[model samples]
Target: MELTFASYNIHKAVGLDGRRDPDRIMSVLREVDADIIALQEADRRFGARASVLPRALLDDTRWRPLPVAKRPRSLGWHGNALLVRRDIKCLHAEPLDLPTLEPRGAVLAELDLRGEHIRVLGAHLDLSGLRRRDQIKAILKQCTRRGKMPTVIMGDFNQWGRLTGAMQVFGMGWQQITPGASYPSARPIARFDRIIATPDWSYETSGVHHSATSAAASDHLPVWASLRTA
Candidate 1:
């Protein structure tokens, strides 16, 4: 089976124009038109954690947000969320505990995409390089505890270099699919946003989803991959 997957950090819908516009974010999503999308900073960083993008807006699309335990107003777990096409079957969704100096964590799902089951994890790792390494260790440990399946993990890594040590952690059973620069969408030079598929799968093609709207939508451009199970 083949799937189009994307990961984005919406920066709470605050764009280059310094406006908080959910509609702009929606436009970017519509342009990507991915089967699965991982989002970071979908909720406000303070207070009740109100979602920047309303549920109604998401409802209007063909996508459904993964059901995870969170505050009624919160869009995701620690600002990490997953969206799957309405036709995709969500077997389970859960929040992951990650050690961070700042509030940060991961969300994962076991989804049945037309009978092909796979685990998809979405995360925004901490900025501190050391903490990022520990967070990756925790995530990998959780993947081991969870039942095995072809997996796709994507999100803002906050790492500037491709040779960063933190990335080495994913080398065990994952293959980097999209390494194109995604940060600062207007002039991306760091590949902060990425998509990695389990070794059991391969990518047909992958790259950063860039456009005029996406550049104005957030600080980070969404990265995507066309992946297929082995």
Candidate 2:
């Protein structure tokens, strides 16, 4: 089975110049055209403010948003979210809690695509090294417990190009699909986002998307890969 997956830190659906524009985000996603999207910092505040990428942005006949958190005034409904195409049967969403000064969580989803089961995990780690290290340990534990299913883990890891945590994850079974330099979309200097997969999936370096729309939509550019079941 062929799969298209993407990981993007929407920056709460805001642009580099601090403009909140959910439509731009939707446009970028529409251009990406991924089957499954693992999104980080998907702001969905209920009372505090309106959602930039509200439910109305997606066609009800083709997509669904997996719930991650209730709208909170303190954080303004900030959390991770998974958006899957309607053809993919979503079996479950497993939420992983990590330690951080800021609230952080991971969404693990099981999708049945053309009779094949695919596991996709999305996360946004903390900025601090100590907190990121602890979060990495928790993620590794979760991966070990999940055993070997066709897995794709992607999100804003918050690690720069020189960080060892990102390299350590790649040292494990996960392959980093995005090239170096992906943060600060206007002038990307570090690779703080990624899409990783296990050996059960074979992905070419060819179809990674880092277009100008991405740079305009958020502080971090959306990264994606086209993969085929190996």
Models, CA RMSD each: 1.0, 3.1
Model 1, position 201, has a per-residue lDDT of 87
Model 1 vs. true fold: TM: 0.97
Give lDDT tens digits, candidate 2, residues 28-130. 8888888888787776444554445677676632567765445532221246778888778887666788877877777787778878888888888888877
The TM-score values for the models, in the order shown, are: 0.97, 0.86
Residues 1-230 of candidate 1 have per-residue lDDT tens digits of 88899999999999999999999999999999999999999999889988898999998998999976388898799899999999999998998889988899899899987788999999998888899999989988998998788988899988876756688877756787655988888898888888878887877888898899999999999888998888
Candidate 1 Cα deviation (angstroms), residue 187: 1.1
RMSD of 2: 3.1
What does the lDDT come to for candidate 2?
0.74
Cα shift from native, residue 12, model 1 (Å): 0.2
